[model samples]
Target: MSKVTILGGSGAVGSIATETLASSGVFSEITVADINFAAARKLVGKLKGAKLSVAELDAENPHSIRRAIGGSAVVLNCVGPFYKHGPTIMKAVIEAGINYVDVCDDFDATEKLLAMDDKAKKAGVSALIGMGSSPGVANVLVRFCADSLLDQVEAVDIYHAHGGEKIEGAAVVKHRIHSMKVDIPMFLDGKFTTVNLFEDSGKALEEETEFKDVGTYSVYGYPHPETITLPKYLKGVKRVTNLGLVLPPAYAELIKGMVRLDITDEKPIEVQGHKVIPLEFAVAYILSQREKLMKEAGINQPMGCLKIVVKGYKDGGKNTYIFSMSSRGQGMGEGTGIPAAIGAILMGTGKITEKGVLPPEACVNPMDLL
Candidate 1:
């Protein structure tokens, strides 16, 4: 009878994770903790056959996180904009002596969490960071190839994209813009290299990747955790790159426009005798346009793919292995939440036996997870 606590459990990914884990019947109790307690309560009402509770949790505040995770065996964090809430909540989880898992996609946050490995190990708590689709499954695929399919891994390419629904969260949009602005890191020429988003520095390995049901679209490099973590984990891996694209040319244009305008800045600017942040304004504008984009694309539901290509050695010779997972409807929820919930279940069951900060591939067995 393990008790699980989920921070930000009222949100889209969190709600789906809550239901998914409850339906698994592996946990004794599932607590949905969010800043908005009412939302948590509403979600709890819909779950059955599990002991559920709702709690107010401000993930940005250490004290609130400490209070929310009390008496819980494991914590699944679905809070967004990891750059803001990641460190605080992680600290609280470690201090409480509980295993932790999160679906963070931000590279900066992942790097920061990596720095906390010693602390987590000292606390005797296992921390699985970036357990969501792209970083999660993508990393596991690389490990599977390196360990089972490849002898001398030369290069790895990871691609992920979503289509059908225009996500309406300003925070998510702002996070995307922020990712675009930062210099993305990749492993190149047997060394680590940094390139701007859409930059033409990294060597291009043309891949004719096919998703299960979604049609193929060209994928270009995007800075994701796989770019940074794979090299460290996969020996002889010379080049590692990650790419992502959104469906419909119009949405791509919109994101490019937002990036070009430098609207993702967080610094406050004075406008009409008032203070405003450009990033905040950009988020609002993006949210307003989501419905129109979805309607124009005739996307009432979402579908996407996370594909990984590993080129190296098999049976002591050159070979290539492609691993892909295609998901439909509830793009963010299913794609992200399912993996997060599975990570939580694994942590609770001691399937993930590592006691340090780690990415999914470093800590999980791909075959077991699949």
Candidate 2:
């Protein structure tokens, strides 16, 4: 029996992923597991076909994760701010001996997950990490270029713009805050390098790019795993860069403002006799302003695009391929979640059989995923 468990299944991305996987009809049973039982139930209630169920899961607790995953053939982790729960959940899933997939976009998390490849191999588990939009589809597209279209792929540039979801969760905001504060790694000139988003190193690479159907916007260096993981797969590639922006430009600016003003500091500080983390206040305020900013931008609904630009040589001459996936009423949730579901579907169908922690490009076939 094909049973799949989705952790964080009620979340924006997880919900979409759950819908996609459940509707595929490949799984005999599907479990929607989330910390919020009501939310999980609500999500499951909306689905029509397949054996759908809900489980209360506290991802912070490995035991809870394992219980929710009980005997599922595959586990799809849709949890967010992956830096926090990624490695923890991965270890738990690996120990359980079930094949796993996750939309882990954090470069640090990817590095940590990849480090556990040996353990996953030892346990006979196939773990696919960064199976979301940028790292997932983006990676596969580049692999396609290298394998079929190009004689020698030299560079890859991945760009994404998404926002306008009904709600911007705190985990999402924390991830943005985390991205801005940390050193972003990018593969350049066949070597690895890091850039600080707030500094000139990052700004130097910023440019205005038009996303098909999603409008034109300025993009900036993002700390996505594609920059780190792609280099390992696309050998001899001189450069691989990932740049993205959340919609309404102002929304992104607000987060950047918080980072600049030091409002995102995690260290607890005194606030009128209370120990408060500035980051919590910053995230709350940013979310409170989301609706206003989105409305001001005339975005009444979710819209987004994922653009991948691959450049290289075809028959010893330079060639370029650009792939774009965009939607008017859907945004990051669909862009990221759908690919994750596809990865799980691949796992469930025996398409991905490698037994080790892996990135999308490492084990997934581009044609199969496409």
Candidate 3:
């Protein structure tokens, strides 16, 4: 039977991916695998299509990941803080000799996975990375502009703002924190460079923009992989930048506050003879105030937009095109999760012919995905 195993299948994006993949009819059986087996079972129980089952998986253990996806036709990884598990899980997929897809937006992780191109080729498996919103769809859009819209693509700017998911999992929050704490990549003057989110390097590129359907908000440099991967494919592109936000200004400020207070340290500390990770505590504090901030921002529904601005010379004349994808009444789940499912579908159906680890823009045809 054709089966697809989804890691972290009980979490926010995982749950949505499970539902979408099951509905595709591409697989005869769909396994919802997560560290929490009961939660996985709970998610599968709600689905009436595609035979669903649950499996316990510890993503930290390569053996566990391999075993969970051992016999699946395709493995879709929805586990996040992609920096933490992205490369490890992709390694397991290749070792298992199975096709794979993942929503990995972390620039560093994307580089690590791309470096494994030789390994994946030896295993004879197709692995698609950065298949989420920003890195996934965003990458495809830029490719479209380069291949179809312009003869010479000079610059590409990606902007995103999404929020009102109601509740967020720890992995999502942790990923956001890690994004801010690390050095983000951007293609500048046809060269690659890094910038810290809180430093002048990142702040200088910051700007306020309006998203279709979503209100205008401040966006900062995001460490999404598109900035690094696009330039490799879109030649002569002088610049590629990814700037995004989670919405509700105060929530972003709360995270900024934690960064300023030196409270984002990941090291465990003894608090009154109890152990606590400062970053963990900060995540909790931010969650406590997220609702209030959203209310004040007047954003109560799921709203998000992926806006791409491309500029270059066409027929020896300056030209530009602005392509924007806005989602209403849907947040990360529909935006990110759906594309992850589509990528998995494409892989499972043998539509993706590439035989090694590759980013969306590198192997995937933009118009086909669009």
lDDT of 1 by residue, 17-71 (tens): 8999999998999999998899899889988977999999887788888888899
Candidate 1 has an lDDT of 0.82
The numbered model that scores best in TM-score is 2
In angstroms, give how far residue 47 of model 1 lies from its true place: 0.6
User: Please, what is the TM-score per model?
Assistant: 0.95, 0.98, 0.97
Model 1: ten consecutive residues of lowest lDDT: 199-208
Q: Give per-candidate clash totals.
A: 0, 0, 0
By TM-score, how accurate is candidate 3? 0.97
Off by over 4 Å in 3: none
On a 0 to 100 scale, what is the lDDT of residue 132 in model 2? 89
True lDDT of residue 182, candidate 3: 84
Q: Each candidate's lDDT (Cα)? A: 0.82, 0.92, 0.88
lDDT of 1 at 328: 73
Instruction: Count backbone overlaps in model 2.
Output: 0
Candidate with maximal lDDT: 2
| C-alpha RMSD (angstroms) for model 3 | 1.2
Worst 10 residues of 3 by lDDT: 361-370
